[model samples]
Structures are given as C-alpha cells and as structure tokens.
Target: MKSSVRAVLGLAGGALAGLALMAASASAQTIAITDGRILTGSGIIENGTVIIRDGRIAAVGASVPVPAGAEVISAAGRVVAPGFVAVDSGLGGNEVSSQPEANDLRQSSNSISAAFDLSWGLDPWSITLPVARLGGVTRAIVVPSHPGSSGGHDHNHDFAGLGASGHHEPGLFAGQAAVIHLAEGTEIIVQPRVAMVAPFGNAGANVAGGARGALYTLLRETFAEVRLYARNRAAYDRGDVRALSLSRADLEALVPVVEGRMPLIVTVHKANDILMALRIAREENIRLILDGAEEGWMVADQIAAANVPVLLNALANLPGSFERRASSLENAARLHAAGVLIAIKGNEGSVHRAREARYNAGNAVAHGLPYEAGIAALTVNPARIFGQQQRFGAIAPGLEADVVIWSGDPLEPLSQPVAIYIRGVAQPLYSRGLELRDRYRPGQQPGLPPAYRN
Candidate 1:
C-alpha cells in the first residue's frame, strides 16, 4: 500500500511540473502581425510583417518572415502604428478628483515640495488605465496639479537652520513627475523623477507674491540655495551652514534640476512667459519642457532655436485667460513648421479621459499640421521628450512591442483600436465602463435593484 501511494505522489508531482513548463512556454510565445499598413514614425510601409519576440520587435519589413510556432495576427485592412504616449496625465494618481481618498495628484500643506515623488501614490489597478489602453495610449508622463494648498500653511519650524518662511513657500516646486506604462498588472512605473514640475505664469505668480517677476526671483534664489546645499551637504546636515529657505528634502530634490540631470516641466502659456522659461533654462543650465504653451506659436522660432520641446492641448484655441489670449488651433502647426518638437496633451486634466489626446492630434492635422507629424506628436515626440524614445516610441526593429492595430485612420473620432500589444503581450480590450453599460443596458433586467446587483 505504501509503495502504491508513493507511485501516485510521484506521478502527481511530475504532472504539475509539466503544466508549469507548458505555462512558461505559452508566455514566451512569439507574435507576428502580417500585411498591415505600418506607420514606422520615420516613414510608412504599405504592407509589412512585424515580428515580436521576448517583448521586443525582432523584425519589421514588407517581406519579413514569421517564425514557426508564433501566434499570427492578420492586419490586412488595418492600421498598425506605435502606441500613443500621453503627457500631463494624472493616471494612477487619482480616480476621482473630488474624492480625497482616490486622489493623489496634489499635496496640500506638505512641507516637502520637489521631493515628493508621485510614483508612491500610483495604483496599478486604476480603472482609468484600461480605458486609456483601449485608446492606444501605452505610456504617459504624469504630473502634479500643484504641491501646496490654495490656502498657505505656516512653516515656522526649522530643520538644520533651514528657514520656514519667505522663499521656502510651499507652491514653488510642485513635485517630481513620473513616466509610467499603462499596461495592466503590478509593474506600472517606468521611471520616477523623470522631471520636476514647476508651476509658472498667472497662478504661479499669484503664489509668489502676485508678480511674475517675483516668481522668477524666487526661482533664481532657490537655485542658488540648491547649489549651496549641494556643495556643503555635510555642513547643512550638521546645522553649521547658513539658514536657507527650503527644507532638506526639497533641497535634495532640486539638486538634480540645478545640476542639469533632470528636466523641468514649466507650466507657462503666454509667448512672453514661454521666452522667460527659455531664459531661465539657459541661465540655470538645466533642461526644460514647456507645458500649456497656449501662445507658443508666437515664439515658434525662438523655441525651436533653443531646441526645447513643447507639450500642448491642440484644442486650446480660446482665450481662456490673459496669458492665453494668443491661443490658436494652429499653435501646433506653427510650432511644427518652425521645427519645434511638440507633443499633444489630453482633453481631461487627469487620466480618466486621456484617450482624447488622439483626437487633439487630429484637430492639429486639420489646422495645417501634416498627417504624419500629428501621429509623431502623439507617439514619438512625448517618448523622446521624456527620454523613452529608444524603448517603445516608434514601430521599429529592436523597440519594445507596444504596437496597436487600428480599425481605420487612428486619428478619426470614430476609429477604434482592434488590438493592443504592450511588451509584446496582447491586452484585453476591456474597461469598467463597458461592464457598467452592459449591466445597465436598456433591455437587461436584474433580479435585484441596480445598486444591490453584483
């Protein structure tokens, strides 16, 4: 009886091991898309075959051959393009803007500005991600709305002789931004501290003593302090250094910005303000990315000369504020014509509706931007701006397989993504909204009340 039991146990263990091997083999399977209208970002291929292996593109050409045992997808009448990369997205940071528990985009009353990392607040399972993925957005650059609350807080406390008042104001430095992948599952953050968000222009001026000049003064002074903090960290930590306006944490965060290692995403709109940001970038010798450049078209030449990239909302054609009086639908077209690198911003400030960035690119196209340039703005431009171009921006050989098969012209309002592959793995075209719609359809009836139904 004991011998028979041992034999059965051995067989069971062997069966489990075989199943595990099978699962591993399935996960490593190659994927191929054949006969698709491939937009390679650099150019277009009428009909090509893209082969993906080990989560990267192995081959891409008109006559590329698919390997044996590979899962093949026919895109004969579809559009195959690189996945969209959205900027200024609030994905994984907030679900509902008004709900405090679900929102993590801002940190009001926190003494730690610049040092606050948004990646800590990321929720991999955020409902908005699936919806964005369905729209072909595979990556994003997430930023904070602002750091401090509208109402100022008292910061009279000191850390190692660091002054709590004046230049150490809360709203000066919003916080660190992050780059993320919209893929499902636990691993979502691609790079933390990708950029430091600094609010500028009208609202920022209000925070800095109600004058734009005052904000620039604070920026200069803050950078000086950052240099001092970096040069004498031991003295500062020991409380032997002179009093500074910022906390130790904030100072540490600005070290990268001052040293030119991290780019600063300055939120400015007016043409003058855009020039001012460029001036500061030169003066401080730091990299800069201009966001919300409503009047960027006016300074297209200057911006292009400086070789700085702009992130914009193509639909921002209205003069919503004094700083945006020069806003135009052709802002993107004018900038692109001047050789400026630009990326499109989403319609929703947060990740909930970030998919609308695709349509924004379409609007730009209608307003004189080239069709190919519009696609590049939605994909390669953002990835390049955030130092992610080499990984998955374009549909090229050796790039990550973040490819999308579209039903038609992707920029068209009615077109949809037929399939999405992130890291060479097929993603489910599912969203919570779809489930809710199906559950509450006109003809559907439930045994229980709507709220009580599972």
Candidate 2:
C-alpha cells in the first residue's frame, strides 16, 4: 500500500508565493532524512541519513551524526532517491495546447528559428509543473519541436489541420531548448540553449520537401554556413556574404552547436537515419543526443561506438509507424547493455506527459532494464549529458536537494511520491485536478452549478 502524497501547496493561487516563503525559511534550516533506503544513483546506502543544509545536501552516509537544531524526518520503511529528471518536455511552456497564445513551445512560422530561445516563454505557474513535481520530477529539459513534425498522439487534436507548409519555409533547424529546475520559485531555467533541435525522419520529410534526404542535406548546408559565418564574421557583416539561407543571428546561435559546446538533439527514429545522424555528429565534431531513435536497438553497437547518448520513450514498444517498426520493449536494456547512456524521455509531441517519466522508468525496469539503470536514466544520466552534473542529479553531499521519498519501490507502478523536495525545500502535491475535485465536491452547493459553488 502507498501513502498519500504530501499536499504542501495550499488550495489557492497565492500558494506559490507561500511556497517561495517556505523555501526562504527552509533555506536557513538544516533538514535530515534519516534511516531511509537511499538510492544514491551510483549505488544504494542502506538505512542512510541524508542531511541537507542551505538548500544542498550537506552529508550522505549510513551513520552521519544528526546536527543540533536539524529538522529530522525518519523514513523508517520508505525509499529515498533523487527526484526524476524529465529530459525532454514542454514543461515551462504549452500550458494550454488549444490556446495558441498560451503555448510557446514551437514556432512553425519559420523553419530557421535557432535564435528562438524557449526560456523567455517559461511559465513557472503552469498547472503542469506542480503535477509533475508531485510525480517526483524535480528537473526538466523543456524542448521545442518542429512545427509540422508528426509525433506524439494528439488526442485532443490541439494541432489539428495545422500543416507546416503555410507561409513558413520548411527548413531544418527548429530552435533552442532550455534546462529547467522545478523548484518552488519563478526562476526555473537552469541553462538556456543547452541544445539546438532538428528533425530527421518522416517529420523531417514533411518539413524539408517530400524526402528525408533533403532534411539531411539542408541541415548539413546550414552547418556549413555556420562554419563559414564563424570564420568570416567581419566580411558577412559588411554585406560581403557567401551563400547563406540562415540569418546571422541563427548562425551565431549555432556556433556553440557546431563547436561541441552545445549538443544537437536530432529527432531520428529509423536505424538508417540514426546511422546518418551519427556520421554527421562525427564529421561535424559536435556532441549528439539522439531523440526519438525508435529503431536504436537495431544498431546499438554503432550508437555506442559513436559515444552518443540516446533519449527514448522507454514504453514505446508497439509499432506506431514504419519508422518505429523495430521498436522493442527491451530497447533501453539492449542499448544500456551495448554501453550507451540511456535517458528516459516522454512521449513525442505531448507536453503534458512529463510526469509519466517515472512510470516510463518503471516500464523499462519491468522489461529487463536494470532498476538502478532505470533510475539513473531519469537522474544522473540526463544531468551528466546536459552538463548540469555539479548542480543537479544524485543524492550525494554538496548536490542540490532534489530528492523524493516514495511509498514503495519507485519503479513500481503502484508506488508514488509520498514526499518530494527540490533544492532542499518540500514541494506541493497540489494540481488542477485536485483543485477541481475539491471545488466541485458533491452536495457542497445543491442549488448552484459546480462552477458557482467555489
């Protein structure tokens, strides 16, 4: 049996402000979680005591002495682990999918939107954030997608009848992605422009003519221009430019991408295209993160050889399309076996499924992925890949207190977050769903409609 989630957030809009105050108050206090089965990401610490001070892990060990004036919470039979990191999501953006003005995830009006930073549109007060926090996800990488790219099931048809071939030119580059911290404050972005995104399979085919080859060619050409722009910046600024399809701003944004400073997160599903993407990564001398590599298991060795990490939808076993025909339940396990870093991402095209990352980890663990590896996929693996190793991930001393106490095995589907803490402060389990249920409680107001009762 699982315990109920801690409702740290109150049933009011001002709850966020209250949480901020709590964070401030907690910042000055030392918190100790003692006698818990701690999954330290590297290994387990049986009956460990994790001490947090000034919003960071002060010490972690089995016999760490509790300091005076420290607030101690005994986790006698609970499982404690670092909060899950949602690698690719639309967390800070896309609050309402149907409302275009509210959702700032993708800009379909332009194919070359490399300068379109996703952090500027981040909404910390989004309903999705608290829900995901309740699910034990404390950090996330909010990504932007190609406007016309066909992925994730849009059950509500939020993007129905939206073709990428409107006034916008269908090129390759989508935009920049942001790494976010789901703490209880307004500033959530950890690093902006962590990766520049591109599409390479059927979605790429849709955007860059009716062929996949064009997408690759256009991407290569863009990189080539980026190289030229890097070398001849002064000349290009004086109107003595070479052949360039992208603007100077975009070329400048992609400079880090080409120089291995920022990774290129390409959405390639087919094995053959994955191979091509690997080759591109090698030839261009850029770090790569393969997103949506549905057929990755087919060429696991090749991916491992390239030293490229793969971000996957761990539960994507059924054949959604021809590109994912080789998708298997053991894809994550096989890739891990082949020495590739596997990060569990959410479903393609869906922004609201960020919280399901832990469930995805559970599914992968059930399908033969090591339980530790599965947990690490949502923690250390992503943090290391995204260059946030020192600040986030793991439950080690000196790291941020992004930890969760689970009612049962965290990977088990039945288990849930009993308590969640981010940056040493406890997070709220409140959500729009809970608010609605409490607001429309039956018989609360028999003479009025449910909306008026509140």
Candidate 3:
C-alpha cells in the first residue's frame, strides 16, 4: 500500500514538470518585425524588414523575405533601431534608499576584492527597469558605488576584504559590477562581470588624505602588488615551499584586471584625472574605460590617442564640480568630432533623468555629432564596451531580438518607444511614473473628473 501511494505521487510530480516544460516551450516562439524604417545601427535602412526566430534575428534587410505564419509587427512610418545600452546608470536592483540592505552597490574600508559579483545585487523587478526600457534602454552595466576612500586611500587593509566576508558584512557597500539584460526573469539574464571599478577623482582625493598624490601613489602601489600576485599565483596555488605570506587584498582583487581579462573602469571628470588615468593605463598595460568624463572635450585628442573610450552624461550641462568647468550640452558632439568613441549616459542617482536618454542623444546630434553616430553611441558603442556587441548592439542576423519601435525620430523630445522587444518577447510599458500620471492628472480614461481635464 505504501508503494502504491509513492507511485501515485511520483506520477503527479512528473505530470506537473511536463506541463511546466510545455509552458516554457510555448513562451519561446518565432517573431518577425516587418515593414519598418529600420535603423540597423550599422547605418540607416529605408523601409526595411527584420526577421526574428526563436529570439535571434534571422535576417535584416530591405529584401529579406518574411516567413509565412510568423508573428509580424507592422512598423510602417515608425523608426526601428537596436535597443539602447546605458553604459553607466543605477537602474536595476537599486531601490529603497533608506534600506542599506536593499542597495548592493558599494564597499567601504578596503580596496581589493575582485570576486565580489554585482549580479547578486540586481533587482530584476525594480521600477527603474521599465522607466529605462520605455526610453529604449534594454541593457546596462550595473556598477557599484565607489568605496568611501575615493582617492585610493587604505582606510583599513589594502584589499577591501574577502568576497565571503564582504558579501555577509552589513552597512557597507563596495564590490564588483555585473552586466544584465533588462528582461523579466532575474535568473537567466545576467551577463559576466566585465570590469572592476576604481574611484580616481576628487572623491578619491577626499578619501586619500585630501591629496591627489596620495591617490596616485596608492593606485600605483596597488597595481604593482597585483603584478607580483599574478607572477606568484601558480606557486601559491601549488602550496610552494617559499610562497610569500601576502595579505594584500587590493592587489589580490586586481588579478583579473592586471591581466587585461577585465577592464578597469575609472571614474574621473577633470582633465588632470583623465591624464592621470591615462598614465596609469599605459604604465600598467591594462585596459581602461573612462566614466563621467564631463570635461573629456578638453583633452579629446589625448583620450582618442590613448584609445580610451568615454561615457558621458548628455544633459548634465550645469557646472556642479570644478573639474567640469568646460561641461556643455554639446560635449558629446565635441568628443565625437575629436574621434573619441562616445557612450551617452543618463544622469545618475535619479530615476527621472533616465527617461531623457533619447533627448540626450538628440541634443548631441543637434550640436555637431551626426545623427547616426549619436544613435550608435547610445546603442552599439555601449554594447561593444560591455562585450555584447554581437548579441545586443545592432540589428543584424543572429543577434538577440531587442528592437525598439519609436513613434518618431528617437532623439526627439516627444518620441517614445511604442513597441519594445526583449529577446523577441514583448514587454509591458507600464511604470510607476506612468501610473502616477494616470492617477493624478485629469483627462484620459479613469482619471479625475471632466472639470479637471483642462
């Protein structure tokens, strides 16, 4: 009798598992976007068609034949482009500011710990996701905030701490960054950790004895130690007889960074910080990318000569910091004209700013940057930086189907993505901001009374 009951339970479980598999299979269907003004992002395509099957772009061209019975989105008179990639923004997994437990971004007190992964900090359901998505941002490099010692100071130990200890510690935020696809499920969308971040600007100086010299010294010493660590890794791994007892956490955390496997993303706004960062990059033979380069226009030639790309905020024309004295609305265009590969980032620390990414790109075009290049900066350039160009950047064959259909030119202020695709699946455009507008503003649908519709 016991065996009979056990057999019945096993059969029921199997049936449920089979049903789940079927449901998943049904969700993964072939979709094709037809009859659109497709901006392939390699360039423009007039009245083009994109065929997607099983979440990958099957074909993209004016003459590509559409398959029968395929789900088609008629995008006539609409603009289609590869979804935008926000290089630097605090989007997903960073809600609930008062709750430090909810924010998983920065680490304080120490410097070196590369094993800290940012994927664990990501909140797949954050309200910020839809806000960015509505503006056509489909992927982002979710970076951690700078550790308290921004200028390369050692507050406690050199390497911040072990990943296990940092992961469990409370009230401290500092760790690694992870790339994420702005998709629904948290489990399947995480990309690999691509870079290790270091704060190297005025903030870094504040943390390092209020001196730029201290920050530079600390950074140099940290990298030197990392170089030694890499040289001795095999010996340490093998438990060699003369393995040195080194507890340098900063150096240890930079093993991947020093080897060029991971790029070092430095936060710097001033020309001096940019030059200093360039010196470090050349001296260490390490890969580097500059973030928050508000004054990058001042030394565009130098940056381009060094082959270091920049991520800049397009709408931040107000002079907030001394380093950004030359900050202008046309900074993006100027940098592009100087041959610097530009990636336009929305303003950090606020959700409202992210919604203006398209406007930011448009402003760049209005100044001097070509319209196509401006669009590519927001889309392909960022994807290339994050190492997802093949999958996420352009509308090409065999790429993930992350396409945005805009009501008009994407850069225009009134433009909005009417339809957005994430891995060939349609996503809802509803967000907290939109919901509030519907609830409070008088007029459409179930809003306030007719008298308030004015």
RMSD of each: 8.7, 5.5, 10.3
Clashes of each: 0, 0, 15
My TM-score estimates for the predictions, one after another, are 0.89, 0.88, 0.82
Ranking by lDDT: 1, 2, 3
Per-residue lDDT for 1-454 in model 2, tens only?
Answer: 2211122222243346335435543644787778889999888999998888888999999999888767666676878999888877888788877787877877654434687898999998888888787777899888885643322322222221323533226436678889898876879888899898877777776666657777677777878888989999999979797657776667899999988899988888899989989988888798999997879999999999999999898888888788888898899999999999999976644357777778888888888899899989999999988888898899998899898877678877667666678888877657788778767876565676656575
lDDT of each: 0.80, 0.78, 0.69
lDDT of 2: 0.78
Which ten residues in a row are the worst by lDDT in model 2? 1-10
lDDT string for model 3 (172-207, tens) is 214456777776665534575677776677766654
lDDT assessment of candidate 3? 0.69
lDDT of 1 by residue, 312-411 (tens): 9999999877889989999999999999999997876747778999999999999999999999999988889999888988989889888987878889
Over 4 Å off in model 1, which ranges?
1-28, 147-167, 445-454
Best by lDDT: 1
